[model samples]
Target: MMVVSTMTSPDTVLDFAHAVALGLSDRPRWLPSRFLYDERGSELFEQICELPEYYLTRAEAAILRRVAPVLRRKTGPVTLVELGSGSSVKTDLLLAAYAEEGASVRYVPVDVSASILRTAAERIEETFPSVNVSGLHGEFEQALPLLEDYGPVMLLFLGSSIGNFNQAESLAFWRRVAAALPRGGWVLLGVDLAKPAAVLEAAYNDAAGVTAAFTRNLFARMNRELGAGLDLAAIGHEARWNPEWQRIEIGARFHRRQTLHVEPLGRRFTIEPGELVMTEISRKYSLPNLTEYLRCFGLATAHTATDDQRRFAVLLLQKGE
Candidate 1:
């Protein structure tokens, strides 16, 4: 069974305009990282994961492969609910593990992109004919609440996506997730660990320039969706590692001062020369910090697996029994 719920409410558009107006009005100018996943942006991100310098995807995949057997045992016969389940390429291992263990597995994948969600759902059903796949098309927060009705679900928030949120946001998100799960429910969280600054920076600003393309694609998205006139050539990608924040920051910097107009918002803005519009931040964390963060939300780490490089970690967290 395949199910998808798009934001039929007009509020989705209003929310976009409100966020854009608010963010662009702020000093330093910014856009939420969530806006970076339109169809083209999603495709670019898939390419980015394959880049030699982008180790996060591969490292997380390695950890998932190693831990899938354990996850199969822990999760038993339950639905696997995944948030931001893009491509879902790495998830093949987990699904395979459940099937091999003779678990009656049902898969629910949630994502904002209908095309991506549908494509992934089709692939999952076709490849693993025995497993049932249900695709939910919506934001994670909205989709999470629906999980409460399911039985013994295991949530998959992979790709270090939690790193997109700050400390407070992360806590609030996990609290909501914890509240949505039944007892013995699990959350498989993929997190990028704090490593050498050079390594982290390289992951975002890859030598192959795919990451750069991905960054610039945001402007293209704005132009396409918001009817914004943006000179793509004038916008360049810049990624820097902030030691104080312990995160890698990526932004679109203007080459020259210019005025931009968005038809949807009916607003115009000016960009100063060399000014940056912050696009995304990938926060790295330590095990102790993450453990405490999860603990605050009533989640305890049941098991953790890391790649041989130890550059990434996947934690199997469960609400207190």
Candidate 2:
């Protein structure tokens, strides 16, 4: 089900290719979080949204619904552009605000999964025929330039996908996003606030084993795409919260010793009897920390709101006009 090819793009420069080759040159053989949403991964994540312990989606949606009116007022004509825009269901809540404002609206959803993008865009067209839905099939870091064509865009980096990047990576990403959008362009982001250790763990390590399956699917993807002999049963899902880092790390742990030979870039890594193949990290943030972080990158805070009891926040940050 996975297709393999050598496609070049802004993000796939030689360095990027070399980095990816070296990064995946590990025993368990890993796939990046961005690849986590390949059709199956996307569906699994959708299921994650409803899990009782996964309070993030519900909480962030609550905040957005409450603040989007005010957010729309400032970022009017709120040309909605969401990065990693899988399905675009949650986004409808905010898009409705733009529609209600009688503002001419355009919705651009960017993602790497062509299947997911095609299906999402089609469904969106059905629900809101007047809404212009464009699909960009690319990763966020590389896809920012594609956004130029749609600028004056109020970008959406929703659903705590921000967690996947580290602080330095985040700053670089924000800088790029800010540069793509001129002054007055808005970025509405959903961030998982720092919370108790147990709560964070439970959400990712769900009872139904959905998250686990989601993690293991990476191996399935690698084996299918890169000719890597990675056995899903040999790996287990691990999610842990790091307070100091204010983030959650998700990885696939190899239980029994097994070496995987990845053929994509001709590399291999020894599989220790038990080792974790780090795949994703989701960072939590506080209001002050996030505000200062974005400000350091030249983006100014336009508005901020949170769910009752501060479970999570959806912030509207803008490039200074």
Candidate 3:
């Protein structure tokens, strides 16, 4: 197992402070969703995945299990690089398929949490000794450039994480990914399809309350890391479907007036009652629309597989000449 640190500790702290300061200062405040995954937050998310209401993990995993062998045959021998790979539970299917083919597999799992990345890398190495596992600890922006060193890699951006970005951000992200891959390289992208608002809402607002805890954990993280001293008790979790955006917006709503002081950034923010601070957005996509969008970045859809309900899709895309 090879683990590389692309970002230093101080750099990570400064980045967090900057994001918090900027976000708190904005009107209709919002924080980058990526910041939500510290160690505890990551664990909470794993629990949320198992909830009956959260069909995304099950749907995407089913698609991967069914398609991994085909993907191995199509891509042949190449590195498997997964961005935002949490726990990497679903990735085992792809690795097993590649291993069965006697292919030399090199996996690069990129993520923000160093501890989780290391643990996942170690576990993969133990589970599949034939495969070489290298963990990249940093944001996608920092880790994508290093892909040039991996050679002929099939990038895996699973979990419909692309939905976190809006139109412009997603395009910019794909452009970077396109630049990172060599010609003929592959991409397996998981996407959650547009569904009924009620289903979408239920997925985020699970009856088990795990999803709510996951949202609240972000504020707890801010308080711990940045010394933000946020009133977690006053903050309530909210998940609502925006039909206009075709997305589920998750936010932290203040039930009463609260003041937060981020010691690291020397910034103070005041929140009024009922003020909702957007934490994340999960945008559901139409297959045709997403495929066309990828084409603009030189990624052509090669194959697509979805769950029986068509609630989710895993698109196998190849970089064009």
Q: Top TM-score: which candidate number?
A: 3
Q: After superposition, how far is residue 28 of candidate 1 from its true place, in Å?
A: 2.6
lDDT against the true structure, each candidate: 0.84, 0.77, 0.88
Provide the lDDT at 212 for model 3: 81
- RMSD of each candidate? 1.6, 3.9, 1.3
The C-alpha TM-scores of every prediction are 0.95, 0.91, 0.97
For model 1, residues 69-93, the per-residue Cα lDDT tens digits are 8888776777888999999999999
Q: List the residue pairs that clash in candidate 1.
A: none
Model 1 residue 252 lDDT? Answer: 91
Model 2 residue 206 distance off true place after TM-score fit, in angstroms: 0.3
lDDT by residue (52-152, candidate 3, tens digit) is 99999999999999999899889888899899998999999999998884566899898997768888998988888888988878888777787888888
Off by over 4 Å in 1: 7-13
| Candidate 2: clashing pairs of residues | 163-282, 163-283
Sort order, lDDT high to low = 3, 1, 2
